[model samples]
Target: MAEEPLLMNFSLGNDAILVQPKFKGGRWRERRGLRKATGPTGVNTDSILERHSKRQKTGNSDGPTRSIDYQRRTGLRHGVISSLFSYNPKIQSVTDRAEQESTTLPSNAPLVDGIDTFTSLGLSPIIASHLLTKLDIKAPTAIQKTTISRLLSGDTDALIQAETGSGKTLAYLLPIVQRIVQISEQKSKNGNDTNYQIHRDSGLFAIILAPTRELSKQISVVLDSLLGCARWIVSGTVIGGEKRKSEKARLRKGLNILVATPGRLVDHLEHTEVLDVSNVRWLVLDEGDRLMELGFEDDIKKILDKLEQKKGKSGAISDLPSKRTTILCSATMKTNVHKLGEISLKDAIHIQAEADAQQLLQEPTTSTDPIFSAPAQLQQSYIVAPAKQRLVTLYAILKRSFSHKGSVMKAMIFFTCADSVNFHYEVFARKVGQQNTSQLSDSTPELPTQCHSSVLSSVNNPDIMLYKLYGNLTQQMRTATLKAFSRNPNPSILLCTDVASRGLDLPSMDLVIEYDPAFSAEEHLHRIGRTARAGRDGRAIVFLLPGPEELYIPTLKHGFKDKRVNGSLSEDILRKAFAPAIASQTRETWEDNATGWQLEIERWLQSDSKIADLARKAYVSHVRAYSTHVVPERHIFNVKELHLGHLAKAFALRDQPSNMGRGGKGDEGKQDTGKHKGRNRDRSRNPAASDIDNARNSAPDPKEAARQMRKALNAMNPASEFNIA
Candidate 1:
C-alpha cells in the first residue's frame, strides 16, 4: 500500500467528541393515539400458537439454531402486519388518494420570523445561555423558528421539513424539554390528587418515536441530560436490542415522557399489561416520513390505535380525553405526511420550510452547490461508474487532490444495502492489490514492494475502518461504533446503510461516497450531506451503475460533472468478486521475495496468521453471515419497475440463501477471528492458498474448506447451511 498523502488541517485530537443529536430540545413530539387490544383476534391466536410451536422446535435443537435471529425478525413481521391493519380504513383511503394525486408545493424562502437567541424562542434564560454556550447554538434554524411558537402554543399537530445537520433535532426537542420542565414544575406545585388512572396515557404528556434503535438511544442520550435532575424519574428509552424485560421493568413504574421506536415500543405495549397511556398529551412523529418509507405505516398505526383505545375509554379513563397534541418533523414530508397529519393532528397548523436549509443567521457562502443550501459548504459531485469499477473510482478519490486539504478526514460510504457495502469493501481490497503490484514492479519504492503490499493492506485495511451500519446493529454495539468514529486517534470510514444518513450527528466526516445510491433522489441528497457540515467545506462522490435505469432522470444526473465511470478490471482475485468467478494471476504479483521465500511460505504454513485468517473472516464470511445484498423485491416478478429481469437471471441463485451460508457456514467464520495470537501471527503462518495449490485431489473442495474452517466455525459440518446473497 502506498503511503497516504498527508495534509494539514483541523487538529485530529480534541476534547471528547460530543455528538449531540440534532433533535435535542426540538419541538418534535412522540407519535401517540395508540390503544392496546383487549382481546385476541383469530390472527393473534394463530400467531401465539405458531410462535409457541416454533419455540418448542428450536428449544431442543442444538445445531446452529436460528432462534435468536428469528426472535427479532418474527416481531418485525408481526409489526408490519399489525401496523398495516391499524391504519384505520379512512387514513388508508386518504393515503391512496394522495398517492394518486400530484400536487407540487412550491418551495418556501428562508424564514423572516427567525429568532437570534434561544430565549426569543421561549426557552428559559439559563437554558438559552446553555444553548449558546454549551451547544454553540447562537440562534434558531428555520425549523425551530417556525415550530417553537406552534409547539408551545399547543398547536403541536404540525410537520416541518429540513435535512439532517440542519439543526432540526433541537427544533422539536427544545419545546418538548421546556414543556417537560413546565410539567415538572406544575406537578410539584399540585399534590398527589392527580390520579394514576387519569395519568394521561394519550393526551397526558409526550412520547418521541424514532424509526430505529440507534435513533432512539441517540435521542434518549440527549434528553437524559437536557431534562436535568428534576425529571430524572420520568424518562429513558425503550428499544428492541436491549433487554426487553429490564427496559419494561423500568417503565413498570411509568414515565412522564417516553422515547421509543415504533416496533419495540409496540412489543412492550403488547406485553406490559399494567401500562397507562390515557393522559399522554404531546405526540411527536420525528422522522415520520422515514417510518413510512421503511413500511412502518402499520407499526405506527398499531402503536397509535393501542394508545387511542386506552385514551378513548369511557368510564374508567373519563379524565383522559381523545383530544391531544401531535407534532410531525420530517426532513422532506410528502403527501403521506400530509395524510398522516390529517389523521393524527386535530386541525393542525402547517409550517413548511425548505428541505435544503441554512444555518441560523449565517451568511450564504456559495450559491452554486448542485444540491441545495444557498451556500452548501460541501463540494457535491457524482461520478457514473459501473458497479464493477466503483472500487477503482473510490481509490481514485482517496488518491485525488481533494481531502488532501484536511489532515484527518473520514468518509461515510453509503450503499443502498449493507451487502453492497461489503461488496465495495471486497472490490477495494482487490483494486489496491492490483495497484500495489503495478506500482512496485515499476520501481515505486516508497510504495511497498510487491513483497510488503499484501501485508500492508492486511495490517491496516483502510477499508477495515469501513463498517457495515444499518438498522440491524444491536443497540450497544451501534452506540460504541458511533462514539469511536466521532472521536478517534486516526481517521475512519463508515460504510453505512440509511441508518446513519439522517438526524444523527457524525462530526468531521469530510467526504461521503454513495457507493450504491438509493432508489430515492431525496435519499441521495441526505446521504451526501454527511460532510461539509457546519460551514466547513466538504466533498461528495457518487458511483452509478447503468443498469439502474429504473431510478434515473436526466435532470438529477446533470447535478454532477467530470463523470468518470471506469469498467471492470481483469485483476487478481484477492477478494472483490460479485460472483465467485475464477480469475488467474502470477504468484510473483504479490509474492514476497525477501531472502528465503520458501522459508517464509513454510513458516506461513506452520503457524497462525491473519492472511490465513481472511478466508473465514472477510467477504467469504460476510456472504455467509448475512443473507444480504439481495433485496427480495428485486427478484419478485410482480413489480415491473423493480424487477431486474435479465440481471436478476444472472443472480437467480443468490435469491435463496443456502443452509450452509446461513447457519453452520457463519458460525465457522466467527471462530476464525475469535482469538488473537500473542506473537506476530505471520512469522509462523500457513497460507491456505498453498493448500489449494498443493491439492491434487480435485483442488481442495468444499469439504477441505469446511475442515480448515471448522475451528473458525462452531459446527463440524460447515457447508450444511448456506446464504445465497
Candidate 2:
C-alpha cells in the first residue's frame, strides 16, 4: 500500500506553514511550504509580546548566542526569531507549568497551596495588616476570594455578583488599591526616570460610580476606612448634594480614588477642567443594576465616552499606559447590567456568588425570568392588616421589637412615597411623644434632644428615636438623619422611601420593615438587602394587606424557590405574626365615643377621613413626583396599598383577585351586631360555625365598650362635647 502523506500545520510569527511528510522505503522525508501569511494589521502583536514576556530570562551572553545560532540554522534574520524564541526548552516548560498553576480554580476545587489570605492574593503588607488588625476582616469572602487574584494579577475586567453585604466592595477595592500601590512604588523606585508625569493635583487613578448619592457617599466612607493609615492614598467623593466649588477644590487637591454618582461625575467632566482621569486604571460601577434602573444609562455612556476620549487624547501626547479595568458589581445580573458590561467592559471575568463561584469569561446571558431571592440568613415574614391599620401595626411591631431593655436594634422602614414617610414620621413622633408626656403637667419633661425642632421633632428617649429620610429633605437633613441612625447608640427607626434602598451600607441593622412593598421585586431585593450583609444575621418583616397583598408573599416565595433558594417565609412565622396583628383593633380615643349613636357615627367618619387623607397625600405626591420627573412614572401610585398591589404582580403574583377596584375596600369590614346575635341564635344547629363565631367575637370590643363608657360620661358632663372635636 502507498504511504498516505501526512500534512501538519504550524504557526510562524504572522504566517502559517503546512509540513507534508512522505515515507519511502525505510526513511521519511518532509517538505515545508508557507500556506498563508497575514498582514501586519491582522497580526496580534500585543498577544505575541505578552507570551514572549513570560519567557524566563537567561544569561545575557548565552541568550544572544543561542538566538543567533537558531536564526542561522533556520535561515531567518536574527531580529525576527530572537524576539520569539528567547527561552530554552527546559525553562519554557517550567514557565508553562507556572502559567497553568495560576488559572482560577472552580468553587469546589482545592486551592493551589491552601493559602487563602489577603496577602496570598498579592495585596500589600500594609493593606493586609489593616484588613486583619484595623478593619477586622480576617478572611476574604466568597466574592473577594474568587475575584481578587484575577483583578490584581491581570488586566481582566470583572462582573461580580455576590449577595448584598457579601464583601463585594472590599473584593474590588483591595485589588485596585494594591495595583495603585504597586505602581506608586515602581514610580518611586524609578525616581525622575518615570514615563508618566503624575502630579499631586492629577493623581486620579480610579473612579467608582454608584447609583445614588447615598451609595456614592457610602463607598467613599468605606474606602476612607480601608485606606486608613495609608496616608499616601487619598480618596474623594463627588455627588450632587455637595457644593460644586468644594468638590472642584477637592479635585484640585488630587485624589488617588474618586467615588461619585454618574450624573454628577458627568457634570464635572463637562464643566470642570481641573479634574482629570485620563490615566484612571480602574472604573468600578457599584450597584450596576440600580444604576441602570435609575436611568443613568445616558450619563454613564457620556462619562465612558469622555474617558475614552480622554484616554485617546492623553495616549497621543504621552507614553503612559491608559487601559482601564472595569469592575461591575450588582446583587442580581439583569439584562441591563449585561448590556452595560458589553458596552463598557472588554473580555470580563464574571464571578457570580449565589450558591457557588463560577468564573465566566464570555459575555453573560441574563435570564428572562425574574430573580427574587433574599439572603439565606434573612428571616422574612409578613403581617396582613388593613391599610388603615398599617401605622398602628407598625407602631405595635416597633413597640414589641424595641421593648427589651438597653437593646440597640436599628431598623430601616421603607414607605412608598415621600408623603407616606413624612406622615408616618410625624404621626409616630406625636403618638410616642404623647405616650411619653408627663400626666401631672400635660407637657413634655425637659430631656436631652438631638434635633432642632422641639414639637415632636426630637426623639432622644431611650425607648426609641425617630429619623426621616426622603428625596425632599435637604442634603444636610439627610446627612443628619443618616448620622443619627448610624451613631445615636440607641434603638432608632429610620422612616424612608426608596432612597435608602439602593446602596446605603447601614451596619448592624437588626431589621428592615417594608412599611409597604417595593414598586417591583427588584426594588424589594435591594430594600431587604440592607440587612443580612457580610455574613451577619438579620430579619425583615413585610406588612402585607389581607386581600391581594397577602398573595404577594407566596408569589415572592415561589420566585426564590424557582431559583432553588430557601427564601420562603415559614407559615408558622406568618401565622404567628399575622394572628396578633389581625386580631389587634385600631386605637379608638375616649373622646371618639362621647354621644351614644353619635360617637359611633363620628368614629366611622373619622376612620374614613383618615384613610382619605392618606390616599390624597399619596396621590398628590405621586402626581407631582412623576409629573416633574422627580421619580419614574412606574413609581407613581395613589397609596401604599395600590403600590403594593402593583408591585406584587410584577413579582409574579398571578391570579390576583381583581374584584377589589381602586377603592380596595375589603368586604366592607363592618361589625354587625344583628349578625352576631343571629349566629348566637343558630349556635345549637351548627356547632362548628358557632365555634368560629365565638372565637371571632371573643376578642375584646375596645371601640364598643369605649363608646358605652363615653356615652355615660357624656350624660354626666355636656361640656365634654366641646372637647371631642
Any idea what lDDT model 2 has? 0.55
Cα RMSD (Å) between model 1 and the true structure?
Answer: 26.5
Candidate 2 per-residue C-alpha lDDT over 1-725 given as tens digits, one digit per residue, 9 for 90 to 100: 99999886954763354342221110011111111222343321233222322342322333344444333332222112211111111111001111011121222211232223778878877887887778777777666777887776678788887666667787888888777666666666667554333445446778999876677777888899997846677899888667889989989888889998776787789989988877777899998887765556677889888888777444332323447788898877667788888888898887765344322223233453333235555656565544333443465566556656444368888976665665455445534434522111212122211232222222333456777777545455566667667877766778888888876878779889987677666778888878877666667777654444444554445323222212222222223333433223422111111111122222232355443343334433432222221122223323332544332221112113232223222224332244333332223223342333233224346344333333332232111111110
User: Which candidate leads in lDDT?
Assistant: 2
Q: How many residue pairs clash per model?
A: 74, 1
Give candidate 2's total backbone clashes: 1
What is the overall TM-score of model 2 with all chains considered together? 0.61
Q: Which stretches of candidate 1 lie above 4 Å from their native place? A: 1-116, 187-204, 229-233, 312-322, 354-375, 386-388, 401-408, 423-466, 471-473, 532-536, 546-725
Summing lDDT over every window of 10 consecutive residues in candidate 2, give the lowest-scoring window.
91-100
